[model samples]
Target: PVVSDFKILKNAGVQEKESFHPLRWFSLEQNYPNPFNPTTTIRFKLPNRERVWLAVYNSLGEQIRTLTLNTLNGGTHTIVWDGTNDIGKRVQSGLFFFRLQTKEGALQRKMVLLR
Candidate 1:
């Protein structure tokens, strides 16, 4: 039988509740501790498993670091930026942008770093 309304019934006595698979689309959340010192965390959600390309860019729109370039499972995931580049060199304090790209599309957000 087809299940409509994006839900299913449990036991006869139990009431219907929202499903656990709540994520329906791709999303990128802002980094915590906006003006972080040593590190910051980035979070994102995926509706399905797909290849992800996440990177951080400078104010000049130049790529500074490629955080991830691999397939991630469907669900919420987290990444941490340690104020360093791909070469493991520390970056200066400034505004930066991070982009999360997937097969569905792309999402971008800005963050700040404090020395």
Candidate 2:
């Protein structure tokens, strides 16, 4: 059975984060420390509740990792990558792409991992 968990309690009663620091539009920020070693932070902003999927790919276009996350709220969110693949194997230094997809569209950004 596929299980979906929602943290309604925490999100409940909380106003949209964008209202406080509103986003001009939906966006995906470039990973910080672009040429990162073993780890990096990826940030994005949403305008509404939606199912968000994020994945990492190698320069050859093969999916290497999936950053597991639940349904997201309309606001900014941070995701961390540890330079590992789905099987927990450490990847070597090179160029990679992080793809964030929603019903609206998919945003893909390039990043580098330096070992």
Q: Write the per-residue lDDT of candidate 1 for residues 1-115, one digit (tens) a residue.
A: 5556467558758588977856789999999989899999999999889999999999999999999999999989999999999999999999999999998889999999999
Quote the positional error of residue 6 for candidate 1 in Å: 30
What would the TM-scores of all predictions be? 0.82, 0.77
Q: What is the lDDT for 19 in model 2?
A: 42
Candidate 1 has what TM-score?
0.82
Model 2 deviation from the true structure expressed as Cα RMSD, one decimal place: 16.9
Minimum summed lDDT over a 10-residue window in model 1 is located at 1-10
User: Model 2: per-residue lDDT, tens digit, 1-115?
Assistant: 3345544466557466554655545689999989998789999998988888899999999999989556889998998899999999999989999999887888999999988
Predictions in order: lDDT: 0.94, 0.87
